[model samples]
Target: MKKKLLPLALAAAVLAGTMAGCGSSSAASSAAHNTAAPAASSSSSAASSTPSAENVTLNFAIWDSNQEKGLRKIADNFEAANPGIKIKINVTGWSDYWTMLEAGATGGSLPDVFWMHSNEIYRYGSNGMLLDLTDRISKSDKFKLSDYPDQLSKIYNISGKQYAVPKDYDTIGLWYNKTLFDKAGLKYPDETWTWDTLYNAAKKLTKNGVYGILTPLHNQEGFYNFIYQNNGKVISDDKKKSGYDDPATIQAMEYYTKFIREKLSPQIFGDKERAEAMENGLCAMGFFGSWNLSGFAENQYMAKNFDVTVLPQGKTRATIFNGLGNAISANTKHPEEAWRFVEYLSTKEAQEEQAKLGVAISAYNGAADLWVSSNKTFHVKSFIDMVKYAVIRPYSNKTTAWEDRAYETLKPCFTGKQTVKQACQNTAKQMNEALAAE
Candidate 1:
C-alpha cells in the first residue's frame, strides 16, 4: 500500500467549498421518487442478502448533479427491493468531491460508497482505503469482470485486487453550432474533416467576436486526444516515464495552442465557460465529452442550434475515453449492504436506467445505444461510433500529482508566456521526476 501526500492547503480550500450547492434532503427525496424506472429487468437476483443484518443506511457520494436524478431513481429502486437498506446520496462538484473524499479518508469517515476515478484510484486503492471486492465479485453469480470493458475493469484492479466496478464511460467529440456553420457558409464537420479543416474553418468562423473552437488546456477532453490522434503518447506504455518530450506529443500540443494564440478561441476559458459560450453562440465549436449530451440536450439554445460529430482527424482519428467506477469504503460498517448496493448499481438493469435517462454512456456493453437514441436532437450516435478510435486515458499511481504540475507548467504556453516547446519540455522534466518518485 502506498500513500501520496496531497497538499494540505489545497485540501483545506476544497473542504471550504465542498458543501456548496449540496441539495437539500427534501429535494433528494423528491427526485428519488420521481425517477422513472428503466424498461429492462434486473439481470440477476438481488446481488446481496441481508436477512441477518440490521437495517442500515449507506452514504453514496458522487460529483455530477446532472446525473443525480437517474442515480436517485436507481437508489430509490434499490431501497424498494432491499427494504432493510437505505441510500443517502451526497452530490458535490468535482473539485470539492475529491477534497471531501481526501478529508474523509484522513478522518476515517469516508462515505459507505463513492465514485472512483482513474487519476485517484491508485492513491486510494494502493493505500487500502478502498474495499477489496475481488472475492465478492468472484463469488457473485450475477457479476463477472468480463461483462465490463476490459480497460475499465482493469483500472480498478490495483495489484490484482479489485476495488470498484465500472459505472459509465465517456469519449470526446466535436460539438458544433449548426447556425454558425450555416451563417459562415461552411459545411458541417464530418468524417472527411482533418486538423487542417478545423484550422481553416476556425479562421473563417472568427469574424464576429465568436471564436471557431475552444482549445481547452484539459488533457482528457482536449489535447490528449490530439496527442493520440497524432500517434503520440502522454505517458510511456511501461508507465515509468512521461512522453511529453516526444516530438509528436509536442507537435500535437503546439497545434492545439495555436488556436488560442491566433485568437481562434478566447485567451482564457475553462470547461464550463466554453460550453456556455457554445450555448450562447459565442463559440462555434468545442471538444466535449459524451456526458455533455444530456446538458446540451436540456439547454434550449444548444438543443436548437448545436449538434455533435466525430472529432476532426489528425495523423489518425482518436479520442480519450475514461470511465468512473462505483467503489465502497474499506472501513464501512455495512460492508454487505455496501457491496449489495454496488453490485446492483453495476447490473444491466441499473446501467440501462442510466442510459435511458441520458445520465451517461452506460458501461454495460450494449446499453450505450440506448443513451445515443435517448436524445434525438443531436447526432449522439457519433460518440458511440467513435469508440473504435478511442484511447484509454493516460494515468499512473501518481497521476494527479504530475497532472496538476503539468497543467501549471503548461499554462504559460496558453497565456503566451512561454513557447510550446519550452513549456512541454519543462512539463516532461517535472512529470518524469514525479513518476520516478512514484
Candidate 2:
C-alpha cells in the first residue's frame, strides 16, 4: 500500500500535466458547476455532544450503484436507531465521482460524508478537505481501530490523523465459465493450477466464436498480480522509483500480453466490456474482484454457469487487496451527525448487513463469512481464502498520475505496435520521472 507524502507543489505540477492533456470543455463546465454549488456550513470544530432532535439530512456519496440497495438498507437501519437524522445517497459512476469530488473540494461543497480511495486520500487529506477523525475515534466507545484490517485502517490514516474508516474490502479472483470448460473437455480451475495451466486451458478453449480469456490492461485485475507472483515489485519499498524495468516485471508483462497476441483473449475490451462479454459467453475466463458478486448474481447466465477459483500461480501465489474508506467533509455543518453515520457504517452489524446483501466483502474480519454464505451459486470462499496470500494494492502519493501515464505508454505493446520490452522500458522511464517530480 502507498503512503501519503506528496507536497502541494508536486501535486499541483502533476495535476497541471494531467489537465493539459485532457482538452475537454465539458469536463471544465462540470467543474465550474461544482465550484458554484452550495457548500455545507463550516463547523467551528468536531462536535463533542449528541446531536439534538432536529431533523437533518446528511449527503452520502458513493460510486457503486450496484451496492446502493444494501447501503440504503444500512442507512435505514441507522435512521431507525437514531430517529433524527436522514441519509441521502448520491450515486455517481467511478470516473465522474472523483471529478465531482475534486470540484467539490475546490468549492467547499463535497458531500457531507463520502467514500475515499487510497489513490486520492493523500491529496484530499493533506489539503485539509477531510474531517479530522482522530479525536472523535479516540473518544468513541462503539468503534475501535482494531476492528478492521490493520493495513486497511492504516491506508486512510495520513500523518497520524485518522481521516476515514474502512467500509469494505475486495481481493482479485479468477472467474471462469464452467460451461465453456465442459465444452472444451477441460477440468475446472483449482488450487493446483499455475500460469502454464491457464495458458494451456486458454489455448484449448479458444475455438468457435468465444475467446478463451479476456486480459484487459487493468493494473489491479490484470498485470499487477502477475508481477508480484513473479517476484517483481511495482514500486520500491522506499517509494522512490518504478520497478517496471526489472527483469521479472518485464517477463510478467510479456507473459500477460501473450494471451492477447495469440488471440486467446480479445484485443479490444475495456473493463466493463470484458465483464459483459463474460456474462454474454464471448469469453471463458478473466481476472476480476470480489465486488462483481452483485452483478454476477443478478445475471441469469452467470448465476447458473459461472464460478471463481484462486488465481493461477506464477513463481508464487499473490492477489491484490484494496478497500474503500468512508469519510466526512471538513466543512460539514453537522460533524456529530456525520461522525455518527460514518461510525455506524463501520460497526459489525452494518458490515454484516453489507455482507449478507452480497454487496461486498465487509472489512470487519469475521463479517466476511456472512458474505461467503449469502450466495450459494458460486464458490465465494475462493475470494476469502486468497486473503492469506494477498498483497496490498501498490500505490503512491501521485499514483493516478504515474498509473495513467504507464497505461498510455504501454498501449503500443497491446496493439503489436511495439515489443513488450520496449513498452516496459518506456513506461519505466516515464514512471520514474513522475515519481521524481513528486
Candidate 3:
C-alpha cells in the first residue's frame, strides 16, 4: 500500500526528542484488544497447518522501486527457507501508495504486509487497521524491539500495543559534491561545523549558476532541524495545540528562512524537478537522510564528488530521524503467515540484506556495516555512524494537514515576505485549527 508524502500534514512543533514519549505501550495495559483486528477463526486453519504446510501466498507492498532488487533477494531467501509461503511485492511511488491505501482502508482490500510511516501509524493503529505485533515481537529473540532506539520503537506504539515493527531509521545529514567544493576552494562540511559555517561556505560556493545550499521552509527538511537546535517546542504538553510561537521556534524558523531570503541557495521545494536538480549538480549542498546515499553515489554527475558529514549544529547537535515501518493488514485472509513474514522481515538477517543492497539505513542495530561496504565511493560509513545521535521525526495525527499550510503561510519568513514572529503566529494559529479539527 502506498501513501502520499504528506510533507506538511504531520506537524512537529518541537524537536524530534519530544515525540519519543509517544509510544508508551506497556505489557501491563489491561483492556481487551480492539475487535478491528482479524478474528482468530480466520487464522485457526492456517495455524493448525503442519510446519511444512505453512505454504501461503501473501502480498507485500512497498513505495520505492530503488530497493526492489535487494528486497526481492531477501524475499527469495525467505521463500527458500520457509518452503511454504511466498511474498509478492507491489511497489508504487509515494503518491500512488497513499492513494491506494486510502481506497483500500475503505474497501478492506489492503495488502497482507505493507510499509508504514510514523505519521500514519497512529491513524491506522488506533482504527485497528493493522495487526498488533506486541506479542510476537516480545517473544522473539530474533526480533528484539529494545535493540532499536527507544524513541524509534515508541513511535509505533499506540495505547500500549505495538502495531508495527520498524523496517529502518534515518538521520539527516549534509550531502556535498566534493569535486564542486574542491573546485571552489571550499572545505567540506564536518561534525564541528555550525549553521553559520554552512552559510558562509554556501555563500563562497555560490558562484556561476551553481547554488550553495538547498533547504525549504517546510517542517521536516527545513524548520524541524532548526527548532531543535534553538531548543523550542512544536507542540503543547497535551499535544492539542501549537508550539510554533515559542522564541526558540521563532529563531529556528528565521534561521532557515535566512538561507532562502539571502539567495545563498535555491528557493525550491522537494519536487521531482528539484530532486533532478540535485542529481544533476545544480546545487552543491543538500540536507537529506542516509536513505538517499546509494542513489546519490550512483548518479553519474553527483557520484563523482559525493560525500556526507553530520548536519551543521547550533546549541547542540540535532538531526531528524525518519523511518519506515512494516505493518500487517487487519483484514488479510492469512494472519498467521502474514505474521511470520513480518517477523522474518524484522530479523537481523533481513535488515543486513537491506543494508547490503545500499538503498537505506536499516533499523536493526548491527546491519549498517553491510550498507557501508556495499558502496566503495567516498566514506559511506558516515551514514551509519550518524544514527547513534539521531532523533526520530516528530509527528502527530494532524501532521500532514497542518504541515502544508504552515509551509505555505510561513514561506514569506524565509523569503523576507513576512517577519519571523508574524509568520510564526499566523502558522501557529493555522496549525492549531487543524489540530483542533482532529
Candidate 4:
C-alpha cells in the first residue's frame, strides 16, 4: 500500500473544511465495487446479496479517461469480494460525456451508475432521471452521508431528497513549468504571489516560440478562479440573478482576457489542449483543477518539468471549489446492484484506495492525505491548501442553460474581437434571462 503524503491530522483538517455554502461544484462515462469499508476485510454488506442479482453487470460511466485506471483498480477490488457482479467502464471526453448522458436519460438507457456533476444535477435529479437514494442511504450501515461534506451533499439534494453521494472535491491550482522558469531566471510562484505578479511574470516568460501562460476560454478551470479571487460573483445569492455584469467580475475577466490582448497567452480554448501546451513546452504556466492530477502525473514530461502551487491572490485569496457525486439510474433494472456499487465507492476503505491510486481527492473525510501522497512528482498539496479560501464553483437550477452559453457569448473577448466589458454585459443579460425563465 502507498503511504499517505501528509499526516492524518493535516488531511483531516483540510477535509473537515467543507465547501461552506450553496454556490457550487462536481462527471460522465465508462463502465464498471464490494464492501464499502475496511477494504482488506469485506465480509459483505449488512444483509445477504439478493440471489436474483447474481452475475449482474453494472455499467459505470465517467468523463475523464485519466481516472479510469485508478477507478478500475477499485472496481477489481469490489469484484473480488462480491463474486456476483461485474463492472464495465465507459470513457468519454468532457464535452461529449454530458451529451451522451442527456441522451441516455431521454432514451431510458442511462448507465446503471454514473457520475453526476453540479452544473447539470438540477436538471437530472429534478426530472426523476436519477435514482432517489435517500431511503437506501439512510438504511445502509456501510455508507453514511455524514462522512462527506454537507455543502457537497446538498448539491445532489432536491426538495430534501438526496439523489447522490459526494465522490471527491477539487480546488484550482496553478501549474508552472519549472524548467521554463529556470530558463527565464525567474522565481517560482507561491502563495504570496498576486494577480500583478502573474501578469508581470507572464510577460517576461513570453519569448521564443513559447507563450508565457494558457488562458483558456473555459470557466471552472479557467477564469472562474479569477472571478472569485477578485470578489466577483457569477450569480446572485438567491440564484435568481446573474452577477456577470458586476464591476468586479468584469474587471477580473478583463484582466484574464488581457493575456491574449498582450500576447502573453495562447488562444487555446479546448480543455485537453491546455495540458498539451504545458507538456509540449508551448506555455510556461496554466491553471487547472485538482481532478487533473491523474492525467498530469501520468505524463512523463509534466512529471519531470512541472510543479503546482495555489492560485495567485487578487483582492483576497480564493480558488474554485467543486466536487463530483456517484448517482444511480432511476431506470436501472438492477437497482440493488447499482446501489451496492455506489455504496462501495462511498466507504472509507474504497475512498482511501481512490486517493492512494491518485484518482481524485476522495470526498471521504481525512482521505486527502493518501491522494496527495499518490503523486510525488509535483507539489499537489497546494490543491488542499487552497481549500481554506475556496469558493464553490457557481451553480443554480438551469445552470447549464446559461453557463454553457456564457462561453460562446464571451468567446469573442478571448480573440480580441470584442471588449471584455461589452461581452460580460451581454453575458449577464443572457444569464438573467435564463435565470428568470427558470
Q: Which one is best on lDDT? A: 4
Give lDDT for model 1: 0.78
TM-score of each: 0.90, 0.88, 0.84, 0.89
For candidate 4, what's the RMSD? Answer: 6.6
Residue 97 accuracy (lDDT) in model 3: 67
Clashes of 4: 17
What lDDT would each prediction earn against the true structure?
A: 0.78, 0.77, 0.68, 0.79
Give the TM-score comparing model 2 with the true structure, all chains together: 0.88
Q: lDDT winner between 2 and 3, please give it.
A: 2
Per-residue lDDT of model 2, residues 1-438, tens digit only: 000122222112112111111100011011111111122223311122465479989999876655666777777767656657878887665666788999999998999999888888888998999999999888877668789999899889988999999988888889999999999999999999999999999999999999999887777778888999999988998778899999999999999999999999998535435545666688899877777676566656677788999999999999988888999999999898998999878777778888998878999879999999998988999999999998888778878878877888888999999999999999999989988988
Candidate 3 lDDT tens digits, 1-438: 001122111111111111111110010101111112223333222222334454588988776544555677777766656667877877655556667788999999999999887767888889989988898888875668876667778878998999888887766667788888999988788887998898899898888898888876445555677788777767776778888888888888777777777787777654443454455567888765565554455455555667887778888777776777889999999987888788878877778878888756777887777777888875766656666665556677756677657767787776677898998999899988989988
- Model 2 stretches astray by more than 4 angstroms: 1-51
- lDDT (C-alpha) at residue 264 in model 4: 94
Look at candidate 2 and tell me the lDDT of residue 208. 93
By lDDT, the candidates rank as 4, 1, 2, 3
Mark the regions of model 1 whose C-alpha exceeds 4 Å error after superposition: 1-52
